[model samples]
Target: MAGAPIYSKADLARAETYKARDYPANVDPAIETLVREMMSGFADKWTVTILDTLWDSGTLRFSELARQVTGISQKMLTQTLRRMQRDGLVVRTLYPSVPPKVEYTLSPLGMTLGAAFCNVWIWALENHKAVDDARARFDEAE
Candidate 1:
């Protein structure tokens, strides 16, 4: 406890003020629609896994990406990559060679999204045990 950090009352008040700001309720309809569409891309389990894999590995060829993503079917990977490319989250490059190599990398927008999602990953890591415990308790109750 001695080494634990403490927040002053002023710090707590400032944090509360920041948290109380209601930006989402007043968002423009078009902007809300666009945000929902963008967020839906991440609603799929495969999309988040692919993004996380690419974020860590950077510029992987199609086969390498498929392998890294683990359990992802070739068809699903191709479809997800194409959708990501269309959404500007990933850039797909094709080499005009005899073998015709293709590679996928996160676009600038994808990098930004990955950065934002890092906080979510951290939160999950921090709370994973608590979540598992809660689920176990709920199951026991049932």
Candidate 2:
């Protein structure tokens, strides 16, 4: 082909390094379960939102977090926090006071997850206009 790109030997090796991996013939079931659990946490919008909010606003009390997250119900927030705690993403602290105050903060693993998601948030903000334009064109075409 006249316009086809040509790759040097070094370019071919670099491209090979970037290629996707294939699982071995005897794959471990535990690895699959772990990946499934990780994907579920990443797929949940509420989980990501809570993590992002916590990442931005240090440690916050339950009421403060609820307010910051916006649109999250008390019950749903409670559930999400519990699930995050189980996954070792968030830490919950209880103060033995007259009213019994409770606070939440991201754990070390949660901080890492938040850092990874920051890139995604940045990409979304940068590409939102293009995405909206594409959606409009598609809608107009239909």
TM-score for each candidate, following the candidate numbering? 0.81, 0.75
Off by over 4 Å in 1: 1-19
Compared with the true structure, the alpha-carbon lDDT of candidate 1 equals 0.89
Q: Who wins the lDDT comparison?
A: 1
Per-candidate total of colliding backbone pairs? 0, 0
Q: CA lDDT, every prediction?
A: 0.89, 0.87
Candidate 1, 81-121: lDDT as tens digits: 99999999999999999899999999999999899999998
How well does candidate 1 score on lDDT at residue 117?
94
Please report the TM-score between candidate 2 and the true structure.
Answer: 0.75
